[model samples]
Target: MGRGPPVIDFSPFYGQDKAARSKLEDEIRNACLDYGFFQLRNHGIPENIQKEILRQSEDFFNLPDGVKDKYNKDVGEFNRGYERLRSQNFEKLTKGDLKEGYFLAQDLPLDDPYVQARKWAQGPNKYPSEVKDPHLWKKTVDEYHFVVSKVAKNVLSVLFDTLGGGHEFLDDFCDHPIAVLRLLHYPPQEPDASELERGIGAHTDFGAVTILLQDSTGGLQVRDRRTGDWVDVEPISDAVVVNTGNLMMCWTNDRYVSNLHRVVNKTGTERYSVPFFFDGNPDFLVKCLPSCIEKGEVAKHAPLTVSEWMKGRYADTFGGSQEKTAKEMVEV
Candidate 1:
């Protein structure tokens, strides 16, 4: 009958730590092992900044469909720009998600090496020029991305400390990492809707870690790893909810659970939440954690590079269609 997730403060673990750091590390380690989700507070992100980012998001989402469509995923190749409602088949459109989103990737220059390589979903953001407060929206989102990415790295450091490992294991993969910032808006739903009328279907995140900034209108839920039940992820003010993902599970050698979660936005009011997905370098090799595996036991999964595994997962979920630029057809 519990109502919410653990609210852990990051201040105790911030730079130049002391006794409080060790205690917090133990707490985070246990929380990761058992819950795999927790809201982090005192992570040094100012309240006004978070609110402004939400405001900017609301403005952009409320824009006319014609305007938003200008930056749709068809244009950005599913890596950046707006994703129309129900376009993503999280549960094969069985009462599919009643939400729309704006996805932002690492804003790389056109001359960047990755851009030249024509990689998937790796490039600058496609913003709707007609948005109200375009400057503020871009600034807010970009700033939030920078701050949140740093916080996620700090969280990883805590995880490494918990695992009794050095930064060498994950540090290289993070430098100029492939990060995704998603802003989602869920419309109001009929109170009589069924359980299958989900705002987002049951699923686990794909990357290393997800840092979520949820608004007051709450609907997020986590599946209990032990019981066959769902627990409400009640939104706490000034705290970002963080969760491990499939990649983390792989890296941890199944030591931690990347529990499945779904969003059922039954509330009659609108809901807004943004999640920052920090992924690894595409080329990083993923294998069993030496600590997680016993002295002689074999690793459950064979070695796979991050990029290869991601491509496989995508091919399995979304077909193996060749991706072209959003402007491909329009190009002369």
Candidate 2:
């Protein structure tokens, strides 16, 4: 299909007529079932805050290599902290994922319950202490994280109703989620590039939902399931792109799809993006929604907790399941 993904406005949720709410729900359902993605606007994040977040990201990524490297340790098995470019390899690329990133999570302490449980990826954020402005970058990110989370919870509410569940479907897990906010920087590419060169590999997100913010220099592409072709997810001014993830597909019993996507940067300018992943509480049980299972259809997955599924997926990506590989690498 040559069509672009749908644009969904969530105004109805802010006390509108019942008819408007119904129409929005229908759009949400159709977008999820067919496109696996949608663009959102009027989601309540301030414009100034978005711009400041991007500015801080650019400032941090522009820091000298030596200064940045001091915090580049692969803590918790590469889950958070500074990761250099080309450190991660994708099977589809001759080069590795060509973007460097700083991974962050809700700032927690060593004695936090999740950390005490030995849950990997749960820790305090890695801040650049030597930077000229104290907490400038950290401030922007922390504020943006709080802002986007509100947007995600609102989206989740719509998703809950779309699956024929009530408002309480996601209420239990939204307040204390296991989410991560990643800031990515893709350098400019040569004017003439080969097919093998890629900014990021084709893969599906491992969590439940992703909300992304990027500059106008667009390079994101989504794989079309019906035609088996790639579609450009162009950057629309002031719009945040949202997509479902693998665990969400499982929860919906395959009613929704988690699309395959990749990124490439050929615009001869640095590209930056921020993607916030919304994960459920570690112990939240993710089971198929009753409405998703028809009379003859059966649930596709057994009852599984969010942390268990996420950990298993990480293991699969890191080749930790194979007997030989498992011995060589520590589990994420």
Candidate 3:
């Protein structure tokens, strides 16, 4: 077993003590720079809400295939509904991932402007009708999304401060953000499964940041930057694992890391985890932060809106063609 990611107590950041907040900021900065991953404890989300969401997720996934298939995501849909097992292959070198998932974003009505315009990942979610208690399921999911979204925003504010940016630097960027909450289920691997088969293949996330709530049955692993070896990210009770993603790496001009991670469920029991991806506003331009660039260093990546980057990545993963009009809209 390799070393676990750092466990960070997030409650101090919310306090009024300047010295304590400063120390916590330094710890977060080091975690982002060195590991790109850390376990966040005492985040404001309630434990009961977390448990309820997981329970609802398990109940939904436990439904028969025919029943669950009613909500299957369309080929071109980026974030909307259910995805069947082996639906994605994050690492092309390996077989399709062995996990199934359901995707939901900021719920919008049919009359919402973004939904009417068919903006990337902007639409109402598809909820299953076959759950044991449909109303409770919807309520739990909505409540979790609402609470976790605030935590994600707070985490981003702290990260920006550490980068020498203003507290409100991300205010506009997070307005109507293209955030996604994914409920993932990984079944036990087959006895004779090849090494090439995995629950989720090695890949880095495409968003700015991800907050993951993992269960007791642990299988998530992160690749160590220094040794090129995979390290286990053990599950800690009531702690959500937070990691920087590719967009953050680009925005910081590589000052912060976006380390690779994957899951392999060797344990004989089913595994479920929920990850909230805060990808930022669709129209917000992601350019390298001025503070992150050294005196004479040039930015590594050109500026691109969150929509452009996310759409391209979704197209690559799902093998869907990009819409010409949407591409042009981002260019303008």
Error of 1 at 232 (Å): 0.8
Q: For candidate 1, lDDT tens digit of each residue in 111-211?
A: 87767777645678876678777787788888998888888898988887887756686778785577889899999878877657878877777768999
- Candidate 2 on 238-288: residue-level lDDT in tens? 789999987777778878878888888878889999989998787787888
Residue pairs that clash (backbone atoms under 3 angstroms), model 1: none
Off by over 4 Å in 3: 75-78, 321-332
lDDT rank order: 3, 2, 1
Model 2 / residue 106 / CA error / Å: 0.8
Q: How accurate is candidate 1 locally (lDDT)?
A: 0.78
User: Which residue segments of model 1 deviate by more than 4 Å?
Assistant: 1-3, 76-78, 93-95, 315-332
Better of 1 and 3 by lDDT: 3
Q: Mark the 10 consecutive residues where model 3 has the least summed lDDT.
A: 323-332
The residue-by-residue lDDT of candidate 3 on 1-332, one tens digit each, is 46767999899878998888898899899999998999999999899999999999999999998888788887334457888998888777655899999989888888888778777778888888899999998999889999999999999988988999675657888888898999999999998888887889887888899999999999999988788788989998889999998888887988888888999899988999999999988888888888889999998888888888888777766655744212221110
Worst 10 residues of 1 by lDDT: 323-332
- Model 3 residue pairs with clashes: none
Clashes (N, CA, C under 3 Å) per candidate = 0, 0, 0
